[model samples]
Structures are given as C-alpha cells and as structure tokens.
Target: MIATVVGVGLIGGSLAISLKEKGVANWIIGVDHSQENLAKAQELKIIDEGSTLEDALQRSQLIILAIPVDAMLKALPSILDKIQPHHVIMDVGSTKEKLLQLVAGHPKRGRFVAAHPMAGTEYSGPEAAVRNLFVQKTMVLCDVKNSDEDALELIESMVDKLNMRLVYMNAEEHDLHTAYVSHISHITSFALALTVLEKEKEQGRIFELASGGFESTVRLAKSSPDMWVPIFKHNRSNVLDVLDEHIHQLQQMRELLAQEDYDTFYKLIQKSNKIRKILK
Candidate 1:
C-alpha cells in the first residue's frame, strides 16, 4: 500500500516511520508545506519520497492528515476533491467536535475516518519524531458509524500495524472525556509552570525545595504553545468547565490549610492519592 502523510511535523513524521517499520505501506510519501521539514524527513528516512500535496494525493491510496485542527479544517475541502471512494483518509488531530461538524455533510464524508491516537511528546518537527511513538497506545476512532466500510477497515488495519488498541466513541463523547483527562492535564501543567516561575521570581527564600513530584508534574509544561493554544480554543467550553472545577478544588484546599485543618488535609491527600491505584 502507498500512503501519503500531510503536515510532516512530529505526528506525521512518526507515523511515516512506523508505517514503514511495520511494513504497512510499500511506499510512504510525505507532504509538508515546509521545505525544511521535507529535507529533514528525507535525511532521516522518515519517508520514501517527499512531494507537494497534489502530487502525493494523486498517487497514494491512503491519506493521513496530522496537521493542527485549524489547518485541518482549512485543508479538508481540497482533500475531498482528491480523495477516492476506495482511498482511506485519517487525521491525528487532538480535538474532534468541530472537525466532525465541519465535514458532516460532505458527500464523501465516509471516506475520511476521524482518529486521535493518544500519543505524543513535548516536541515538534520531523527531527523530533521517533519510531514506536504510537506503540501500544490507545487510538480513538470517533464516529466510526460515519466512516465508510473500506475506510474503517483500512484505518483499523493501520492501527493494528502500530500495535495500537482500537477504541470507539462519538465525537461528543470524545471531546467530553478528552477535556476531563487530556485538556485538563494541559491546564494543570500550565498553571504549575506559572506557579513555579512566579515563585522562583518573587520568593527568594523558597529555593531549597527540590522534589520528584514537582519535576514530574511540571514536565508537560514544556509542551509547545502552538499545539496547545488552538486546542484550548476549539475545546474552550469543555476545557474551561473542567478548569473551573479544578480551581474550585484548589481553593477549597487552601481554605482547609488556612484553618489548620490537618485531618481534612490528610483526607484530601488520601482521596487524591487513590489516583495512583486507579492508574495502576
């Protein structure tokens, strides 16, 4: 099988490499608007060949759009014209609600499968991509009912090649769970960064605190703002709703601290500590 992957950034580059490694694609063609990325992808052997969108689309039977949500919306209409009924198209964008709505009425909507593989790193560009990025990850297939039989089968086959688990949900449920699990984690990370940076600046006496928990929680703060800003914007209502509840919980914790409530604080820590067992 020949596959064309657009927006050869981290996700696209990673996918191209994995497909080649798994022997899922006989020829993996990369398409990116950036000349630098194309050069890097070629140098790194992430793709068999790099070409313009038109050239790649015309030759390949499978298309993968790993671009940002906004860019995905802009590029999708042009995609519709080139995509054939037998060809399967998939995206690895973070948010799904808006993308689903935008393409819902397209006559060839079934040819496109909405996919979000819950895998990534705090890095970008073709150079940042690594093999096995999607290995054993949960790859969510949204609104599978809306995708064509061939498209769905092809998409699932690719996931199997990557050793990914297939999970299904509608776009609405995807957004809701993503907001609670994924989106809120970003907010927590950003707030933690702000908290640390502000403390390092204003509190000179607080420098002695060195802990693993702090390092672990703040690691995700290093993520790219370019990727996050749009996600927060597109999933604003859900993200903000979860964030409000999170802040409320923090404020409640602060009140307990102010009152010298050790019992309440211990219970609070124990309740949150249960997450370790839940995660395990």
Candidate 2:
C-alpha cells in the first residue's frame, strides 16, 4: 500500500515507520506545512518522499491525517472533497466528536475512517517518532457504522498489521471516555508541573530532589501545546467536566488533611488504589 501521512510529526512519523517496517505500506509520501519537519522525516527515513496534500492524495491509496485537532477540522472536509472511492482516509486525532460531526454529511464520508491509536509519548516532531509505538496499543474506531465497510476493513487490517487491539465506539462515547482517561491525565500532569515549578524557586533543587514518580507525573507537561490546545478547545465541555471533578477531589483531600483526619485520608488513598484493578 502507498500511504500518505499528513503531519509528519510524532504520530505521523511513527506510523510511517511502523507501516514500512511491518510491510504494510510499500512507500510513504509525507505532507506537512512545515518544510523542516518534512525534511527531517525524509532524513530520518520516516517517509520516502514529501509532497503537497493534493499530490500525495493523487498518488497514495491510504491517507493518514495525524495533524492537530484544529487542523484536522479545517482540512478534513477539503480532503474528503478530493478523495476517490479507492482512497481510504484515517485520522489519529485525540478528540473525535467535533471532527466526525464536521465531515458527517460529506459525500465522501464513507471513504474516511475515524481512528485514534491510544499510544504516544510526551514528545513531538519527526525526531520523536519511534518504531512499534502502536504495538499492543488500543486503536479506537469511532462511529464505524458511518463508514464504508471496505474503508473500515482497510483500517482494521492496518491496525492488525501494526499489532494493535481494536476497539469500537461512537464519536460521542469516545470523546467522553477519552476526557476521563487521557485528557484529564494530561491536564493533571500540566497542573502538577506548574504547582511544583511555582513552589520550587530554584530549578536545580527540583532536579536534585525529583524522583521517578515525580518525573513520570510531570512528563506530559512537556507535551507540545500546539497539539493539546486544540484538543482542549474542541472538547471543552468534557474536559471542563472532568477538571471540575478533579478539583473537587483535591479539595476533599485538602480538607481532610487540614482537619488532621488521618484515617479518612488513608481511606481515600486506598480507594484511589482501586485503579490498580482496572490498569493492571
């Protein structure tokens, strides 16, 4: 298969690498607004060539949109406008509801598949791309009923080639669940990082005192704003809902600590540890 990756950033570059390595895509043509990113992806051998979206669309059988949510919203309709029946388009955006809605009535909607590979690091750019990043990860397909069976199957086959697990959900359900699981975590990490930075006047002291847990908790704060801001923008209500609950939980803990209620505080932590059952 010939695949054209639209972003050439972390997700796109990594997908390009995996598809080539696993023999799923015989050649990868990259499309990105950033010339430097395109050049870097080529230099890293993440893509065989770089071209405009129009040119890549004409040449490739599969088009992967790994751009930010905002860009995807703007680009999706036009891309759908250009797709032929033989071409399959897929997106790896973090949020889905708004995107799916935007392209809902498009004539070529059947040619598009909404997919989110639930795997990534707190990194971006072509250099951040890693092989096998999606291996064993969950790939959520939102609103598959709206997609053509052949388009859906092509993406499912690609997911299989990448050694990923498949999950199906409607766009609304997918957005809501991601807000709870993924979006909230990044927001919490960013907030935690800010709290530590505000309290620790000296950066050197933070580096000296940081442990593995602290490092891991703050890692998502290092993620690019270019990617996350649009996600928060598109999924504003869901994120705000989760954030409100999170703040309430923090306040509850603070009040317990203030009252010197050690027993209750301990119980709260024990309750939190129940996440182990789900995660493990």
Candidate 3:
C-alpha cells in the first residue's frame, strides 16, 4: 500500500525507512514544510516520492503525521477535509487529548487512527532517522475502536512489521499514563541537565566528571525545546501535577538529610529500587 509520511523528521523519516526496509508499503511518499528537511529525507532515501498535503491524502492508503504537537492542532483539521474512506491517518505526536478533541466531531474521524509509538531518541530532523528505531517498541493506539476496519488493519499491519506491540487506550488514559511515564522523564532530564550545568559552570568540568548515570539521566535534555515547549504547555495541568509531586519528593529527600533521618532515607531509596524489577 502507498504510505505518505508528514514532517519527515526523526519519527517520520524513521517510519518511512522502516516501511521501505521491511517492504511494508508498496510506495512511501514524504511531505515536509521545510525544504531542507524534504531534501534530507529524499537524500536519505526515506521515501519513494515527495507528496503534497492534498496529494498524499488522495493517493496514499496510509498517512503518518509525525510533526510537532502544536503543528498537529492546525494540520489535523485540514486532513479531515482530504481523507478518503479508504485512507488511514495516524499521528505520532506525544500528546493526543487536544488534537483528538479538535477532530472529535469531524466527518472523517473514523478514518483517522490516533497512534503514538512509544519510541524516540533525543534528536530531530530527517538525518536523525535510524533503522533500529521502532524495533521491540510499544505503539499505543488511542480511541481506535472508532476507526474503520480496513484503516485499523493497515495500522496494525505496519506496527507488526516494526515488531512493535499494539496497545489500545482512550485519549485521556494515554495522556495521563504518558505524563507519568514518558513526559515526566523528559522534564526530569531537562532539570537535571540545568542543575548540573549550573553547578559545574565549566564545560570542561562537566565533561570531565560525567559518568554513565549522568548521560542516562540527561539524555532527553537534548530533545528540541521547540517541540517540547508546546507539549508542556498543552499538557500543563497534568505536567504541573506530576512536577509538584517530583518537587515534593526532592524536598522530602533534602529534609530527611538535614534532619539526619537515615533510616527513613534508606527506606525511600529501597522503595525506589523496586522499579529495577519492573523496568527490567
């Protein structure tokens, strides 16, 4: 089937590459507003052809929107006008609630499949595409019971090619869980990076003292502020709720240390260590 990927950045380019490499799509078309990205996507051989917004919808059986969260607010509405009954539209944006709300009453809503592939790297643009990106990932499909049978089948088939599991959730549930698991991780990474940079002040000292733990914790700080700013803004309530909890926990640790509550601090660390088994 012909697949058209919008934005053609890290997620879109990687998806196009995966589809082409796995023989998942009969043809892969790419659409990006940035000419530089379009060129990079083409140079990387991520798509079989470059497509227009209208052209991609008319010609493609599957369309993937892998753009920024804010851009999706405007883009998804336009898709409602162009999508055919046979076409399937899936967005890989981090947050879903607002965008889903925008299209909730659309005539072609059933043709659009809201999906979030639980995979990414702290990079952007077409050049950041990687062959191993989607392997062994969990792809959450939100409110898919409303999607057309054929449209849903196409998405399921493509996720299968990536060896990713398909998970079903509503828009609310997806955003809430992702806030706790995925979004919070990014915020923590950003804060940790800022904290270290503030403390070290010297870039040389930062590089000299950096270890595996620092690298692991600060990795997501490399993610684009352009992309994340809107995400945090749009999901403000949930993000702030989680951030408050995180800050409270941090304060509690500091208080324990100040009071010399060694036993309580040890128990807290032990409880946090339980995640090792769960994450493993």
Candidate with top TM-score is 2
lDDT of 3 by residue, 1-280 (tens): 7899999988999999998888888798899998888987888888777868888777878889999999999988888787677778889988989988889888898888899999999999989999979999999999888787888888898899888988999989988888998889999999988988788778997788889988999999999998899889888889999999999999999999999999999999999999999794
Better by TM-score, candidate 3 or 2: 2
Candidate 2 local lDDT, 35-102, one digit each (tens): 99999999999999999988998889999999999999999999898888999999999999999988
Deviation from native of the Cα of residue 124 in model 2, angstroms = 0.4
Per-residue lDDT of 227-279 in model 1, one digit per residue for the tens? 88988888899998999999999999999999999899999999999889868
Model 1 residue 201 distance off true place after TM-score fit, in angstroms: 2.7
**TM-scores for every candidate against the unseen true structure:** 0.95, 0.99, 0.97
The residue pairs that clash in candidate 1, if any, are none
lDDT of each: 0.89, 0.95, 0.89
What local lDDT does model 3 show for residue 107?
89
Q: Alpha-carbon error at 147 in model 3, in Å? A: 1.1
lDDT of 3 at 10: 88
